[model samples]
Target: MFYRLMKMIVAPMLKIFFRPWVEGMENIPAEGPAIIASNHLSFSDSFFLPALMKRRVTFIAKSEYFTGTGVKGKLTAAFFKGVGQLPVDRSGVRGAGEAAISSGIEVIKRGELFGVYPEGTRSPDGKLYRGKVGGVARIALATGAPVIPVAMIDTEKLQPPGQVKPNFGVRPGIRIGAPLDFSRYHGMENDRFILRSVTDEVMYEIMRLSGQEYVDIYATAAKRQIQEAKKQAKQSGAEKQP
Candidate 1:
């Protein structure tokens, strides 16, 4: 009841505010357990597409979102909650993957539509990065759900990293690809590799719709780690030089 009311209220408001141009919404199942896979671009990306969708789509949000308290924090929590998101803590170095997979599988088992970003995190460079097979395909294979590839363009431009509000003029939009069926590969008997390949195929479709540059390297939390190491080494060498 709350989910339905949320869909009713939020969808129209988003359309008016974002003026989003939607495509291929027909690809989404009017009824069934399905997964919508896409590349992550911005914080607003989650809210944007779900507003365009007719069905109630749920995504996994970081647990911090639910824990925070304040004006902005409560508003943020309310927005996510209204949009059918459940908190999944993907914060630590370990156990995060297991936790996510378990939560996702449970969501699917209830015959709900699930949303996942295959690229794992937002593109720092606006280029589609390699996907970590982690738990997306695992849940799909486990639940026998079809994966729908969606591409959101200009979303990053709407709310680039630090700003509190969207820039408000860029007309955000989405291009959805056809639903991918992995029925042929079903029941492969715990074949993780095959599941990854299936994940890649779904990502390939998203790349086509999004038209973003592709990077084969995995998205790592080590970006700052590597940069800081290089900086320290350079400073040390300079001090020794004279």
Candidate 2:
């Protein structure tokens, strides 16, 4: 009820303001379970993708979004909950991965659309990063669900990292590729090699759709490198100031 209400209020406003376009509406199945494996370009990627879809799509969100202490935190938690996002604690790597996969499997079992950012985190520089191996592949293989690759274009420009407000006049879009069938690898979810192969295949399709430069390193690693470089540059500037 809340999901529908939010969409009713928010979707039209987004369409009017942003004029966001979509390229592959038919690629989305009319019904049944599927894993929406998308390239995470911006925080708005979550909003734009679901707004355009006919069916509800649920994504695994960080627990922090739900655990805020003040009034702002309460609203944030309510909004995410209303939108059908599941919260997974990301403090422990293995535990978080397993929890996400488990949540996805349950969604798939209920014959709903389960969205996942195969890149694991938003790209640090608007380039496609190599996908992490566990969650998407494990869920797809476990549930025999088709993996759909979606590319969110120009969203980073709309709201880049750390920006509180979105920039207008930038038209964002979604490019959906055909469903990838990993049915042949069904029951091999535990095999690490199979997981990597499946994940790479999905990431390749996302790259093709988004036309973004592909980086082989993980997005998290890229973000760390960027932060370290900024820290070093700041130190060098301080030294020069003295």
Candidate 3:
């Protein structure tokens, strides 16, 4: 019920507003378990890709958006919830990854679509970074669901970083790639080599679609450090407020 309602309401509004140009949409099965792996560029990339396709695509979003106090926060939370986003706390380093994979696997097990940004977070410099490969590969191997690579072009520009509002006229494109079946890798549950191979294949598809340079190393940890710094600064400010 929630998925259908979102598909009908928010999806159309998004399609109209963005005037999205989509390609290779046929890659997605009309109804089945699949994972949409996309590059992260902007926050809006989440809302845009899901709206471009008629089928409900579930992305594991940061828990903050789904938990809030004000009306604005509540509305944002409700919208994402309606569109099939499950919140996972990304605050901690160890547990968040496991939680994300578990939630995504549950969605796939229920025979629904799940979306993941293998790069983990938005690219700071618009380059495709090496994927973590843990969550996506594990879920696909577990559920036997085909992984579909999705790429977004100009989404970062559509809704520029940190700007709450998007510029009305920019057109965004979504490129979908063929479904990947790792049946050959079947039964290698404990094999690390097999998992990395399949995850690389999925990311390769994303690179082909987005035409972005791929990095062998993962995204920089500088952003996380900056976040920690900000929190510490805030705490210091509160303590000094005598």
TM-score (all chains, Cα) for each model: 0.88, 0.96, 0.86
Off by over 4 Å in 1: 1-5, 225-242
| lDDT for each residue of candidate 2 in 180-208, tens digit (9 for 90 to 100) | 99999999999999999999999999999
lDDT of 2 at 118: 90
User: Tens digits of per-residue lDDT for model 1 on 57-117?
Assistant: 8888888887779897887787788877878777684677777777787878888788888
In order, what lDDT does every prediction score? 0.81, 0.92, 0.83
Structural RMSD, model 3: 5.0
RMSD of 2: 1.4
Error at 163, model 2, angstroms: 0.5
Best by TM-score: 2
* Stretches > 4 Å off in candidate 3: 222-242
RMSD of each: 3.0, 1.4, 5.0
